[model samples]
Target chain A: MDPISLAFGLILDPYVLTVMVLAGSFGLFMGAIPGLSATMATALLVPVTFFMEPVPALAAIVTATAMAIFAGDIPGALLRIPGTPASAAYTNEAHTMTMNGKAEMALGLSLTGAILGGLFGSAVLATSAPVLADIALRFSSFEYFWLACMGLTCAAFVSSGTAVKGFVSLLLGLFIATIGIDPMSGHPRFTFGNVDLMGGIQFIPAMIGMFAFAEVIRSVTATTPHFRPPQERIGNIFKGLGPVLMRYKVNLLRGSVIGTAVGALPGAGSDIAAWISYAVGKKFSKEPEKFGTGHPEGIVDAGSSNNAGLGGSWVPALVFGIPGDSITAIVIGVLYMKGMNPGPTVFLYQPELIYAVFLSFFLANLMLLPLGLTAIKSSKRLLLVPREILMPIILLFCIVGTFAINNTVFDVGVMLVLGLIAYLMEENGFPIAPAILGLVLGPLLEDSFITSMIKADGDLLAFFDRPIAAALGVVTILIWIVPLVVRLRRRGRLPEGVG
Target chain B: MKVNDAVPGAILIVFAAGVFQQTLGFPPMPGQDYGSRLFPQVIAGLMTLCGLSLIATGIANRHSEPLFVPAEWMRSPPHFVNFLLLVGLLIFYILVAGWLGFIPTAFIILTLLMTRLRGRGHLISTLAIAAVASLVMQQFFGQLLRVPLPWGIVPPVYW
Candidate 1:
């Protein structure tokens, strides 16, 4: 059978369809909440996905994330709070719209934009990924080493807070990755004479710790007074959405394009894409002063962009085994566990599976229409689920999820310790995403570097011998050097008594 | 609580030094010039540089920022207790869940946390929610997913 038909067969299976619907609902719930995020939704789903076949597992994640990104806009329209960071870019604009009694229109605009932009992104993924994979198949360890470095470097730089703090978080992750046996020499590095440590830290429990459990801690410790969710009646969201789409058609297209491009960049994700798209939309708008005053222009752009980014991120993840964001970082771990290790080779070995993922993206975005509409209509009740009751339940789920990974208390211990550390790290203004990216990429980076070094026989110059490797190496080095040079130059230009 | 960057910086420096010290003992690989120690040492070296930079920044901003800032929750007795109870409950589960079993332990943890967070007025509701939640979790994770959650002294139920 053709890969397309095979993909269709896989996606159309009753089990996979059921998983997608359930996951879509789960994503909407998580994303409609203020504190929970799309990443958190994905993190929490990992344990359940652990038991499923690869197709359903990947489908569940894909469906959940896409739904979550779109659903984030719901709370942004209802309450002033964004359900996820991706919605944060336009939370004020959306809330202003709600204040103006245009709640249905605001939600309608977001929903329509998300679905359209997501489809556009899926189209690009379907057409472009295999082509990229073909080119990626030529890459060797040297090239891979540079790509991995570039990804990690981009993560550290793009993360919020000081670059130094991001680098520290990244280095912490790398150090943790080294705790098991040395893959190169078959000797233990940092196991501290423990048998469980020999296999290294499992990223699943670590992810639950960093994202879900840490969030639980944060929610419990928060001293802010409970927010009274606004009670609003949502009417026909589809009423009069067409002329608005027609009016902002150009913005929608621009946003999707920008979102895909930005999301395809390693380390940048939907949140960044949404911010950039919103800014771009505001910049080009004829009525720039009208922005943030119940304006739908920026909303149309960012709303679409964030959802479009979900598909765009998969490009690097599937083609290069380098994640484009923290979500894909988890996807890579799951891929490795499924033995369909992501990269160009996955395309060659199982094109059908890749197509299945693509199909699920389309299915998910289509499913988003009805499901998103339902969520918007029910926003009041969804937001009313008090955090006090929800949090303890989530904590229990975290414990169960962590324990199910290996059925070992040791893994649960790892979750607790790492979760505490993560809470402390975040409290001090350190970003957790880079650390996750670092942890996911650390093994790949080390392996590629070691293999390249061995092949080059200790000659540093050999790292740049290959044309592709040289180009990639130069780019990675320039990213590091350029920032420092700029900083130094700025310092030099300052007057002597400036301080 | 949040602390000055210098605190974590110094901690990282000491930790990196320990890593460097440990990596020094790794035996070199035969026939290869680089060994298992190379990657870790490089990481440790980079980490040391980052740590120094953080310390420098911390010192520069010392006057503007406090050396330590207690989170607002620390000042509120109820909020502080909530934070402590959450952490303490997790540790309690980690210590006793295996011997006491998943369901009972989950029930106790959930009930205690809910009562603290939700207050005593909803005691019956809290107990009911905790009971149903624990049972549902057991059914979902243990039976459906086959997670092998410990039964301990409780007789295992067959579906």
Candidate 2:
């Protein structure tokens, strides 16, 4: 089956089409909730994918994740509360726009930006995935180990103001990752004798607990007086798409490119892609000052770029069998479980299935536009909801969602414990994002580092011998040092007696 | 409780020691070198370093305020208790899930939790919620896909 034939077949599949729209809408709904993130939605829904035909399942997951990601901006825009940490950067600006009576306009730009970026990212993925996947295929375990390390490090740093703090977070994640059966020795590293611990911490549950439950804990504590959102007298939310288009064409293009590039980087996920693009956007925007103050451009650029990141991340999975983000990582696992080995092999061997996936993604990306618009309109009511009322429901979702995965009692316990810890950590000015990243990437770094050591007879130089590995290592070091040096320079030589 | 500096420092030192001890307990691999302990030891060592750093930084920024509890959190006992109870509920649900089955356990947990949190309505909501949750999980997850749901008190029809 040729790609074109598969694509047409996917278009005609009723199940695939229905799933695309429904999942997109569901993603938007879940993303609008404070803690139920796109990643969680994707993970929880992954189990369900086992029930469907490959095309519908993949399309549903993709559509839901994409729409959910964009919908995160809605809460960020309406309530100074960001639905996902990715939207945290633009929370101030979007909320301010809402306060200033541009709620409709703010939502409009965010939706438009998300649609444009999704389209742009899909186009990039459609065109350039083959080339990038080829490059990614050249990678060995050596490259992957470093790549994962680099991702952990970057995620850690971007998540916080301090550099060492980020490193610590990555270390923590590595530590947790190492908890399960030692990939090398088959020895249980951290599980003390319980069969349940053999699998280590369930990522989805821990992620939900850490990211979602933690938010519930915070909302419970931070009793800001509930007030209704100021009514937007403006009739049209799509008030000013022209300026956004004319002014931010370059930013949008560059953001999509960056999103695609970062997304292709095996370890760098969509969240990082969005942040880096926003950094790039603000750094180069002619009206940099207008950013973070409700300029539709800022919200649009960030949202669109992040959504574009979805495609970028997918490219590696489809072609090289490597996941660029946590969500895609699950998708890769699902594909394999269904007997598809994603990579050039998947494209060449299972042409029909692969093309169906590609076409499904295309429709999924397009589907986000209407779903995003509908989300914006409905979620505006979130602003009208009382915090006390809305928060409890969100909390319910988090609890139910966490328990739904694995249906394990231990997991629910883990969620509660982690959430409590997250709440305390937040209060102490210690960020939780790095911690989650640490929990995630910790074992990957350790496994690779140790495996590489064993493979190379314990020679440290072996890590740097491979050019790609060396380059990634150098980049990681640079990422660490540059921040340290800058901070020291600003703070006047680190107060002389530092550490 | 130790002040900020002493608290983190003391805690890290204690926890790092435990980590070290745990790492040392891994069984050695007979012929295949690089025992499981090696990885844990390495991570624990890194953790020790980080812990020490936390101690140093925490002390550097220490003030005369309370050591264990932050001022903002001191006023919110109900919320704190609420959080703890939520956690407890999850643990309870987990314990009964295998025996009660996924649908029943989830429904029960949802009802009990919502009611405990002062959610409105009474038995009607609980039974309604339980029936709905059971049917949804059955049709969607169990029937549609072979993912399998738990069956304990009442045997799962599919299973």
Candidate 3:
């Protein structure tokens, strides 16, 4: 069958359709909550995916992440508290718009912009992934080592906080990844004689612990003041969105392009993409003075950019098997668990599955329109769900979900310990996303490095002998050195970039 | 209680040192030049450097202001007590959930947390919510998804 026909048939399966709706709703719910995130939404779905077919499993993650990114705007508009970090960029502007009784217009523009940006990103992914994968198929261990280094370097540099802290987090994750038996040496590294540690640290449980469990602790200790839901009744969310989108069409296009580009880069994700697009939008806006005071221009651009970045992230993940962001990092784990090892060969080997994954992005974005509207309309009621009830329920789910992964109480113990570790790390301003990415990529990094070393007979210069590897190695080195050079040239002054 | 960045920085440095020491004990591969310890040793070295930089940054900023900013809930005894209670409940669930079973454990934890935290006088409503949520989650995850929730004393229902 033709790829398009095959993709349609796969997506149209009753099981896939049902899973999409359920996942979409769950994503909306998670994103509408003040403390929950897109990463947490995906992490929570890992157990559910265990019961699903590969197509539906991939579909669930794709659909859920898109919905979550868009739904983040609901809390930002109503409560001035961004439901997800991606919405943090424009939360003040969205809240200001809400105060001025333009909440519907703000939400409508966000919804529309997300759809457009997502479709644009999906287009880029569909066209670029195959070509990129074909080229990436030529890569050997030498190329992969540099590629992994490039990813880790990007993780350290791209994060908004202290670069040292980001590196520390990455190192911590890499250390955790080293706990299992050595792939090449066939010796246990850090199991410390524990039987459960032999299989290494379970990724899903650690993820649930860090993202969901830590969130539960932070929410309960709850220092932030809760505002009563705004009295403004949301009328036609689509109202006046068309004129605003038309007026700021250039901003929308620029945001989508920038977001897609950023998302394709390793380590940078939708949150960073949204913040960058918003900053860029504000910089070039004709009515810059109107920003943070009910301005729709930045909102339009950032909303589009964040969702677009989601699709863009899939590019690297599907093509190179390297995650473009933390979400894709988890998606890569899911891909591996599903026995769909992502790489250029996947394009040739599983064309139908790849096309179906791409098509699901389109379908998910289309579904976002109706689902997002319903979410915005009833957002007031949604926010009213007391944390006292919701949090405990979430806690129960976390416990059950961790256990469900390996069906072991030992995994729950891992979850508890790691959850505490994550909380402490975040409390000290350490970025957790990079750590998660490091854990996902650590084994790949080790395997590639070892293979390359053996192949070269311990010659360090051999890594740079291949033209592609040389170029990649040079690029990675430049990424590390250029930032330090700039920092030194400025006499230790940090660039005024979006944190 | 929150400590200054210097404390975490110091802890990381020590931790990295310990890891580096541990890597010295890993048995080398017989034929390959790169052993199991090479990547971890590299990670430890990087961590040590980063940890030193963090320590420098923290000490440089120390004279400016107090680094510890306690949460608002910590100021109030009742709130702090409530927070501790919740933590204790989480630990309790982790310890006994397998033996007590998911449905009963979840029901008890959710009910207690809700009543103490937000339920106040709405006892009946809180109980209803706890029961319903526990049942729905049990049925969805255990039966529908085949997660094998511990049965404990409750009769297991097959769907």
Candidate 4:
């Protein structure tokens, strides 16, 4: 059978369809909660997916994340709190719309925008990924080394806090990655004489620790006043949504394009895409002053952009095995575990699987229409699920999830220790996403560097010998140095206009 | 609690030094010039530099920032207890779950945490929720997924 038919066969299987629907509902629940995020939802889903075939596994994640991103807007519209960071960009605008008794329109626009933009991104992914994979098939260790470095550097730089803190978190992750046996020499590095340490720290438990468990700790410790659910009832969300979408058709297109472009960049995800799209939407609007005053225009752009970004992020992940965001970082881990080893080779070896993933994106976005509307309709009761009861249950789920991966208590211990450290790290303004990216990419970065070094026989300049490698290397180096130079110049330690 | 960057910076510096020290003992690959030590050494070196930069910035902002800032939750007794209890409960599970079994341990942990967070007034509801949740989790993960969750002291029940 051809790849398309095979993909159709895989997706249309009853089991995979069941998994997608269940995952969509799960995503909507997780995303509509204020504290839980799309990344956490993916992290929590990993162990369950571990038991499934690669097709269902990837489909579950894709469906969950796409639904999660759209569902985040529900809380933003109702309670003025973004369910996920991706919805934060237009939370004010959305909440203001709710305040003005336009809750239906606000949520309606978000759902419609998300569905359209997600489809556009999936189209771009379907078209562009194969072509990129063809280009990527030519890459060697040197080129890969530069790409890995560039990805890590971008992650550190793009994080919210000081670059130094982000870099430190990344280093911490890299150091943790080195704890097991050295892949190159078959020698132990930092095992500290423990048998379990020989295999290195497992990323699954570590992810649950950092994302889900740490979030549990934060929610329990939070002293802020709880938000009340919106009093207004939502009715006929799709009513009159057509004329509004028709009016903002151009904004929708622009947001999708911008979202796909931004999301395709390594280390930038839907959160950043949403922010950029919202700002761009405001800047280009004919009535910019009305923004944050129940304006649906910015909401349309950012809402679409965030969901579109889910599809956009998969490009680099599928083509090069380099993740575009933390969620994709988890996907990369899953890919490795499944022996798919995401890269151009996956395209060559299993084109049907790749097509199935593409098809799943389409299925997920279409599923979002009904699932998202149902969530919006039931937003009040969903939001009313007390965190007190919900959190302990989630914590139990985390423990079970972590334990299920390897069925070892040692993994559970890893979760406990790492979760605390993550909590402390975040409390001190350090970003956790870069550390995740670093952990996922550490072996890739190290292996590529070591292989390239061996090929060069200790010659440093040979790293830049290849044209593509040279360009990537130069860009990566400039990213590191230019920021330092600017900082020094700002401090009067260097002459102005030195560049 | 949040601390000055200098604190974490100094800790990182010490940690990097230890990593660098440890890497010195790794032998080179038999035929290759570079060995297992090179990658770790490079990471340690970069980490050291980052640590220093953090320390420098922390010192520069010392006057404006406190050595440590207690989070608002720390000042609230209930919130502080909630934080401690959650961490304590996780550690408790790590220690006892294997011997006491998954369902009972999960039930205890969930009930205790919920009662603490939701208050004594909701004890009965907390118990009900915890019982149902633990059973559902056992069914979902232990049975359906075949995760081999420990049965410990309890008799194993099979469908």
Instruction: Give TM per candidate.
Output: 0.99, 0.83, 0.96, 0.98
Candidate-wise lDDT, in order: 0.92, 0.68, 0.88, 0.93
Worst 10 residues of 3 chain A by lDDT: A490-499
Error of 4 at B43 (Å): 1.3
State the lDDT at B108 in candidate 3: 90
Whose TM-score is higher: candidate 3's or candidate 4's?
A: 4
**Most TM-score-accurate candidate:** 1
* Regions of model 1 farther than 4 Å from truth: A496-499
Candidate 1 residues A1-499, lDDT tens each?
9998999999999999999999999999999998899999999999999999999999999999999998899888888889999999999999999899898899999999999999988988888999999999999999999999999999899887889999999998888898899889999998889999999999999999999999998999888887897777899998888999999999999999989888888889999999999999999999999998999999999999999998999999999988888899999999998999999999999999999999999999999998998888888888889898999999999999999988888988898889999999999989998889888999999998888888888788988999999999999999999999999988887867495
Each candidate: fraction of true contacts kept?
Answer: 0.84, 0.44, 0.66, 0.89
State model 3's lDDT: 0.88
DockQ of each: 0.82, 0.44, 0.66, 0.83
- Residue pairs with colliding backbones in model 1 are none
lDDT by residue (A148-183, candidate 3, tens digit) is: 889888887787678888888888888899998887
Candidate 3 lDDT score at position A188: 89
What tier of docking accuracy does candidate 4 attain?
Answer: high
Evaluated at residue A372, the lDDT of candidate 4 is 88
